[model samples]
Target: MSIPLALQNEKFANCQESIKILYLVDDNFRCMCDDYNITKENVEFFKQKTEEDFQCRMEYETLSIELEEEILRYIAERTDQ
Candidate 1:
């Protein structure tokens, strides 16, 4: 699971403080979406531009490995199922 270089520099984690990279990938290891905490307000503002099924919420803080892992797990679990 290699992350994008642009996303890599987009205010993500340092294995210590917090992780803010939201990597929304499809089944083929391709990123369907990517966003960071700093840009969440923008996401909310422009969310209506995207389609109905596609959604990325801002309820969760973007500074935790658990959140990243949870999203990965969700992708993995759903794809596997």
Candidate 2:
């Protein structure tokens, strides 16, 4: 898989890269579903997955700008906390 564009740009390295940092969340979704014997009717797993995929793609599309904005926002947010 390709990395975000903001990561590719050296100019925005300090600001963007720092904010673009995402910790890969451990999703045991498949294991959970199997363990629980989940049924589609009881869970909207597929829908949630589709939504996440779309959001990720959108993020990837505007990686540079979004990452820069996110980094700035994160820095500002840190001050408030």
Top-lDDT structure, candidate number = 2
Error of 1 at 5 (Å): 53
lDDT (C-alpha) at residue 30 in model 1: 35
Residue 63 alpha-carbon offset, candidate 1, angstroms: 5.2
Can you write out model 2's per-residue Cα lDDT over 1-81, one digit (the tens) per residue?
A: 223332345564666533333312223533443344345433567788889999999888889788899999999989974
Best by TM-score: 2
User: lDDT per residue, candidate 1, 1-81, as tens digits?
Assistant: 445444454344452122222333343323332343336546756775564334333333444567898889999989974
RMSD of 1: 23.2
> Which parts of model 2 have CA positions greater than 4 angstroms off?
1-43, 64-81
lDDT of each: 0.47, 0.56
CA RMSD of each candidate after superposition? 23.2, 23.5
